[model samples]
Target: MTEPTSANADREVLQMIPKPATAPEIGPWLWAMEETRRGLLRTVRGLEQDALDWRGASGEDNSIGSLLYHIALVELSWLYEDMLLVEPPADIVALLPHPSRAPQGGLQHVESETLAQHLERLEKARADFMRHLTPMTEADWHTFREPPDTDYAVTPAWAVFHLVEHEAGHLFQIREILRRWRAQERAAP
Candidate 1:
């Protein structure tokens, strides 16, 4: 092979540069998110309505539906708000309504939504996320500044890891809810 001339080397270097880099990437973080998505589907598939409706007799947090909504909220919000950090911003809240604050009443507090609705919404959010990520410019990821969280200081890269981990954490919660509900069913006469 012949050695490259200076002109050729300069051109190659120029080609390597991209528009921007908006995030840091760790491959395991992405794998973890995909795995969580699978687990969430497994937990809910073929289950009856009551199973979806069930909130643990002891838990105080939101139901599976609320958790799903939270995941969607973060995904789309990051896409428009932080990742792009646009002005006259994309109003994701209007597109995806957030749950209103309400008084708690045992399981009734979390029993606020059906399983199918939650899953369908999450599915769409996942699709949108994949679309946005696929063609992300290298410049977009590298140029990305860290977004501020009141209690947390996070770089664009960390945000991806955090979001992925957050979904996984919630998926595990769903797993527990399913486990608890199944136990209740088995105990029933």
Candidate 2:
């Protein structure tokens, strides 16, 4: 049998073991987030610029580009606004140029950005989130942070859980969009 290269060997493993995280308490949550991100990245790999921006003819729905931007922005928002209880520092602010919401209460439309730019933004948000939580104690992980304007409070643990769920949902959406994009292309005269 032929030997597989290191890169191919890495792809051969299809298991769900939780890798070690920054802290023992957060190991599983971080694992979930990391796995979800891997799936998302795989889904969007090699997407052309137009596929990133495509809105599927109706032109009002969220595109893959907007979803990618929103996912990154939500992680940063939770890290700063919810957990740290402050505005995103200047460095984080520079990573996301658009406001979180559009005028019509949807994700802001992100266009013209290459997939590489979107991935970079996501990496920044994920890195910042992991770094900020590395030193978190068990008390902080379970303690709730109540924002003044929000209807409900959230703990670090629950917030990280929600991020995993959120990203998974968006990943499903991205896959469906990709499926439709290909179907449309096939149907074109």
Best candidate per TM-score, number? 2
- RMSD of candidate 2 to true structure, Å: 4.4
| Model 1 TM-score, all chains together | 0.66
Error of 2 at 135 (Å): 2.3
> What lDDT tens digits, residue by residue, belong to model 1 across residues 52-168?
666567655456666666777677766656665553124335446544445543222435556666777677776666656545554554455545553433344566677777888
Q: Give a tens-digit lDDT track for model 2, residues 47-77.
A: 9998999997798778999999999999988
Quantify all predictions' global Cα lDDT against the true fold: 0.61, 0.89
Output the lDDT of residue 164, model 2: 97
Using lDDT as the measure, the top candidate is 2
TM-score of each candidate structure, all chains considered together:
0.66, 0.89
